[model samples]
Target: MKTALSLCLLTMALGGCGNIAAVKSFNTPYGSPTSGDTARLRVIADGMVRAVPGKDCVDWYSPGAGVIAVPQKGFADRNGESLGMPKGATAMQGDVVSEVLVPAGKPFTLHFLDGGRGSYNSVTNCLGMFYFVPQKGADYEVVVHGYSACGVKLQQLGAEAPVQVTKAEYCSAMANF
Candidate 1:
């Protein structure tokens, strides 16, 4: 009886050791909108990306609204090419291409998690939070990269350069507490 109890406790403890956080699926309104009050934002992630609603910054420890993006399977084979990685960066099997609508001129935040090897008990997992304001009727793309050190870049679709974005200020403060 004692051995069985110990085994059960061990299983429970190990179950919670993974680096990935539990998040719901974020749902965008059906039918693409052509209004100037909204903008299209594409999220590309090798692991997963969570869209946290509201302008306020949220920390990593806290759960967000839900996961908005995940890695796409067989995307590279379908396209027969890569989806444009930054110079000196290695490409994953397939990056997730998820599009969603965001309020124009409003602040939006995203939490990025690296698809590190081994979902459970992974030491290479990295997390990053970034916020940006979208312009009306414009399309934007957010690319997330890295494992041990995650990086996020935002750029307007068809633009040659990436736009400047800052990390969530609240997350830093929360870390101090």
Candidate 2:
């Protein structure tokens, strides 16, 4: 009985060592915006694998409202490309930069450009990945920004408050060359 009591007391004491805070789940309220963050990423894979580094890469996707954006003529494209990496290093044209949605950590594909230049993101002699996360069911204009493979300025993105709630979305805005 004494051992059991001591164990219980010890356990309780350890458990109460710090302030027990409640963790909020990621189930954000519909249309309620969270911290809309951005990142830099190199195109990894695409729908069909090719002889290019960014041929079949996973891409960055922003969600909100009822529209998804990318670096196409307008928005919404199954296959896209991101010059977001070292030239001839890996990234290539025709690589889709609109597959990944709600990228946070690790590595994800994205249409990366510095300011509004048509260049790929480069980390020394290799390609890099960028991640972006916007609010759910909200209207957001995301701009993907980053430095060119040669360490030049490159990024494009925008975020707007949701006018009408919609399902999760993904897109990649084009950066000027």
Candidate 3:
């Protein structure tokens, strides 16, 4: 499992992970701007693969696709849409956060950016994907802990009464990832 995740991450680091140009089909053009009210989203996506006690790894596949978001109308597409996170664990991984503007008021599925491998030898350790709805004008912070599990966690980082997060505060919070 570790080897697979490592390979995926390596591919991503080498620019082999699914890229916008690598996808042959699409619901919209690659890198198209949000079509409606958009909210800023900050994500700390992780691609680490951890071993769970007594559980066989089912997601040992290759081609880490970085982070991906698909609207309800679009099928899975391989592209480097996530913030810059590496394929495996490294001291520099903390720097690989992503911020993007996505359509608000719609539910989108989030996929692991590191799951862009061409095929799979197993199934359990498959990358985790989740759903989210971004409120118009609201900003969100999400943390993706690993690839082999559904560790996608999120919180609203903005204050309702117009409070801005300080660099110190954000840096402190990011350390948890």
Best by TM-score: 1
lDDT of the structure predicted as candidate 2: 0.27
Alpha-carbon runs more than 4 Å astray in model 1: 1-36, 59-64, 72-92, 118-123, 169-177
lDDT of 2 by residue, 1-177 (tens): 897676556546544322111111011111112444433222233222111011123222112221122232332233343424323223334323322233232222233222223333334232223233333332222222232243211222232332221222123331100
Residues 1-177, model 3: lDDT tens digits:
898787668557645565432332222222323366866666555442111111112121211212233322233422234543223222234324545665566553344434333245544344653455667777766555543444555666645332222111111322211
In model 1, where is the ten-residue run with the lowest total lDDT?
74-83
The sequence of per-residue lDDT tens digits that candidate 1 reaches over residues 1-177 is: 897676556545544323112111222212223454877776666766766544546543433344566563311111122333333223455665656676678667776666566564575676777788888877787778655446777888777878777676554553211
Any idea what lDDT model 3 has? 0.41
Order by lDDT, highest first: 1, 3, 2
Point out the higher-scoring one by lDDT: 1 or 3. Answer: 1
Estimate the TM-score of every prediction. 0.59, 0.20, 0.43
- Considering TM-score, where higher is better, how would the candidates rank from best to worst? 1, 3, 2
Query: Candidate 3: lDDT of 21?
Result: 28
